[model samples]
Target: MTHHTDLLIIGAGILGLSHAYAAAKRGLKVKVFERTATPLGASVRNFGQALVTGQPPGPMLDLARQSRDIWGQWAQLANLQLKRNGSYLFARTEAEEHLLEAFCAGRAEEYGYRVNLLQGAAMNDLYGGQFRHHRAALHGLDDQQLYSREALPALINYLCRELKVEFHFSTLVRDIEPGQLHSTAGSFRGEQIIVCSGHDYQTLLAEQIAELNPQICHLQMLRARPKVDLNLQHALLTGLSCVHYGAFADLPEAAPVQAQILRDVPHLHEHGIHLLISPTPYGELIIGDSHHYGSDPSPFNAEQVDNWMIELAEQTLGCQIQVVERWQGVYGSRGPGPFSFLRAADGVSVALMHTGVGMSVGPAMAERNITELWGEV
Candidate 1:
């Protein structure tokens, strides 16, 4: 069978779905193709943290703020559960505390967000005694969270049912040209084509993606089901995250924090380990992650790295967590750039390597890309 649409999107991850939603909302006929039966990529495997507070200043941060707003609107419309649980970057050492103080004092506004610096009694009053041992914490009051496992499907449902966007699943795209895409299901013809395929350098525009020599980042993540019900009010991050996130890294104060981390926790740094613990609506804790980068990262999950992650989480939260699930996620990355965009051909754009911020900035980035491709719509 043959199909036609005003816009054809390849890949059904958040990026592709965002493009479909944006185009369809503008009254363009949109069709999406997914090689898998469902979204099984980084879009579904992430923490689903729509984090704007951690984005570096400038275009990336702007896009994240916009995307966060869009996610809230869609969540209400679709009746999806969106958790507006803020984030806290807590510091354990005096050096880490200095870094947080500097960030809250100087760089917070530059990063285009407000954060409260909590310590001692104030921290205990807000987050309870669990955080009392920590020297200081930066509270980002506007960060949001959603269960990607559920939210992605809800977004797809909303797009299809309300916007009439077409979706073809388990359809492998064999090739893509300027105006048409050849797929296992059928050939699709559209005026514009947007490819949001992540870490899939072999399919579609293999030659172009190869030319870029993009690095693939593999991360190990785990889910812990606490034996007791614990309602967490905020997504907790450790001082390690301050060094990992670009917004904090760009700050001058982050240098000493990074140096301290490298000197003190060299093993954690070796594995790109940072602690992020987010609580799900069901009372389970989703924790992660360690980063290993290469063209092909080892499929073996490092038990040692997982242990380190859990230890850090336990120390920071001061609680015992039972591991219930474990997994790995691989995504495309090009250092420094929040994302990479390639012009495969006229009327065709390839968006990939969104690093760890796909859920944070995907929607607004897609909207901007579509507007750039078609102009003034």
Candidate 2:
């Protein structure tokens, strides 16, 4: 059978869904095709942190803020369990503190951010004195989180029921030419075709993706059920994050912080280990993550990486955590940018390499793309 629509979106991750939502809202007949039976990719396998504050200044940061606002607005319509808990980046060393101070001072006004340097009483109040780690912290008041497991399904439902967008699951696209997409199920034709294939580069546009030579970043993440209710007030980050996130890298103090990490925790620097803990509404904590980048990464999760992450979590949070679940995610990375959008053919656009900020910037990117394609929507 042949199906036709105004806009056809490939890949059902956050990026695809965002485009579908934008197009449908603009009264376009939209059909989405997913290669898998269900949504399982970097979009779902993440901390679900819509971190706006950590994005480097300029268009990327603006896109994050816009996407965060869109997520908040859609949470009500989609009935998603969204948490606006913000984020606290704790500094365990003086060098880290210096980095945070420099970041807060340099970029706050330019980005219109609300960040404060916390110490003494202010620092203790973050998790009710649970983090008596003996150093300073930076509080970002704009960050937010959502339960991706819940939010993804809710979003798909909303798009189907309210916006009348059609979705075809378990459909693999074998070929794409001009305005038509040939898949295992059938041929889908549309006025415009957008491909949001995350890490499956070779499947769709092999030549272009290969030429770009994008690096694949595999991350290890885990979820632990706390013995008692931790009642975390915000998403927690560690000093290592200063070097990991791009927004902090440009600061003059970042080099010193990186040097300190290399000196004290050489293994962490070697494996790109950083600690980010987000407490779910159900009293369970989602912790992660280590970045291992290459063209082909090992399938096995490194036990030492897990141990390092858990150990850092316990040390920073000042509590013991028993991990209940562990998983890994692989995403496309091509240095510092919001995403890579390539025009494969006439009316055919490829969007990928979000670099792990899809949840934070996907919606805004979709909006911009839609407007570019059809204007004013």
Candidate 3:
């Protein structure tokens, strides 16, 4: 069978869905093909936090801001659950605190949101989350989160049912031509095609993107049930996160913070581990993760990494956690870029987020790409 659409999107991950959304909003007939029955890639494998605050300035940050608005629109349109309640980045040391101080004092407002500077233990007093070593905290007011496991599917359904988008799940694209692509399910034709197949660059546009030498960034994610009611309203991150996110990495104070963390925790940078804890509406906690990158990512999920994360979460929250679930999350990374976008032969384009910020920036990127390809409606 042959399917024809105004726009054809490969991969049903966040990027693909975002493209579908942007195209459909332009009144184009859009069809999406996914290798898996559902989006099982970086889209759902993450903490579901938007992390707009973590984006560096320029194009990446601009895209994040635009995507945040789109996410809000989708939440209401699709009746999806979204926690508009921001996020928290805490300092475990004086250096980390100084970084947050300088960041807040300088240009955090340019992020298009308010960032409240909180003293070490003040978070516990206001939000009931106890971080034992907190020196200061940046309460980023714009970051949002969705329980992507549920919200993403709901968004797909809304796209199909309400916006008239078509989706072919479990369809593997075998070949790409000028205006068409052949999939396991059938042949699909579109005026424009977008290949956002997460981490499967070799299968699509190897020549255009392979030279960049992107690797699979392997990560460990966990869901735990806290022993007590923490009443934490905001998503949480630690000093490791401050240094890890590009937003603060450029701050003069960030170098010392990173150095201090490396000196204190020898295993952290070794394993690319950072601490992020967020709550699920159902009362479970989302905790994670450790990073390791390679052409072929490790099949082994380190037990020590999971143990370390749980320990860190416990210390930060001042409560024990019973881990209910665990898994390995993987995404394509090109070392030091936010993402790589390239055009290929025959109206085909490739967009892959090198960082896990795809969920936060994909929609805006899609909108921009679609406009550049076909011009705005």
Candidate 4:
């Protein structure tokens, strides 16, 4: 049977769901298709950090802030367990610390986001007194983190019950042409088509669409059960992971990058790590992240990264951690620009560039762009 709707969204990940919610809210009949029985893509695979601290100043940063506000509002309306752990980024070295201070100085007032520089006893006291090894660090107050594992299920349930969006799971789309998409189940046609396919861009769009050289980075992260209460209530980041998040890996002078990693985030860089510890209302901690960038990297989940994260957790929060869960995530790779919205043709748009922070800006992006295209919603 052919499924006809006003709008058809391919790839029911965070991006797809965003479109579903936005379109439906605008009174557009929407149908979303997911290739997996469950959302196994980066949308649900991430730590669910609606990141705002690391976004560089400009439109991307503005979009992130807007999306973040929407996430909080939606979660509250939907009654989901969302954690508003303000995010922090710090420099562990002198040079790195200076750079962060410079960054904070310029945009501190514009966004009304506070970025504080702490040191000596002040720094120690602020960060649990365990990470006294840092020279300087920047903290951003007001941003929050989401548990993707929980948010996806909650959002999907809410959308189905309230918005009347149709979701077809375990349905792989074999082809997407001008006005139709072919799936294993049947054909889906709509007035407008938005391709939300993440890393699978190659399959749906041809070389012309993908010539932007969209790639992906594979990462390994683990979830651990803490032996003791961390008493930590923020998304913690250090120089090592912050540098990558700051999108400055390929800087001409590599020394500044090193200084930034070690000086700004000594605690994290010394161990090559950063952690997003959201003490699940259930008492477990979600600690992660080690990065490997490539179009298609080798299988990268390492017991070593897990061990390293656990050890860092112990050091940062002064508590022992037990390994309870482990996993890997694939995020869109860096490209010429921050994000891309290629209007391949009238009524056919391709949304790309989650930048590992899609959760931060997905909904607003969907609502604004789709509404502009459709002219009513």
**What would the TM-scores of all predictions be?**
0.97, 0.97, 0.96, 0.87
Model 4: how far residue 324 lies from native, Å: 1.5
Segments of candidate 2 deviating more than 4 angstroms: none
- Top candidate (lDDT): 2
Ranking by TM-score: 2, 1, 3, 4
Query: What is the C-alpha lDDT profile of model 1 across 51-141, one tens digit per residue?
Result: 9888888887898889988898898877888877578888988878988888777778555586788887887876457678888888887
Q: Give the higher-lDDT candidate: 2 or 3.
A: 2
Regarding TM-score, does 1 or 3 come out ahead? Answer: 1
Candidate 4 local lDDT, 1-377, one digit each (tens): 67678998988888888888888888889988888887888887787777776665667677788888888877976677776757666565565665666555655566555567676777788746665767765766656777777788888888888988888899988887767889987998888888888877567776645678867777767777767666556677665554565522333333686765566546556433565555555667777776666677567466766777777667655568887878777877676676677878766788887377788777778877777777664
How many clashes show up per model?
0, 0, 0, 13
The lDDT for every candidate, in the order shown, is: 0.85, 0.86, 0.85, 0.72
| lDDT tens per residue, model 2, 235-317 | 88988988877788788899998888888889998888889988777788899999988886569999999999999988887
* Span of ten consecutive residues with least summed lDDT in model 2: 333-342
Candidate 1 Cα misplacement greater than 4 A, ranges: none
Off by over 4 Å in 3: 109-113
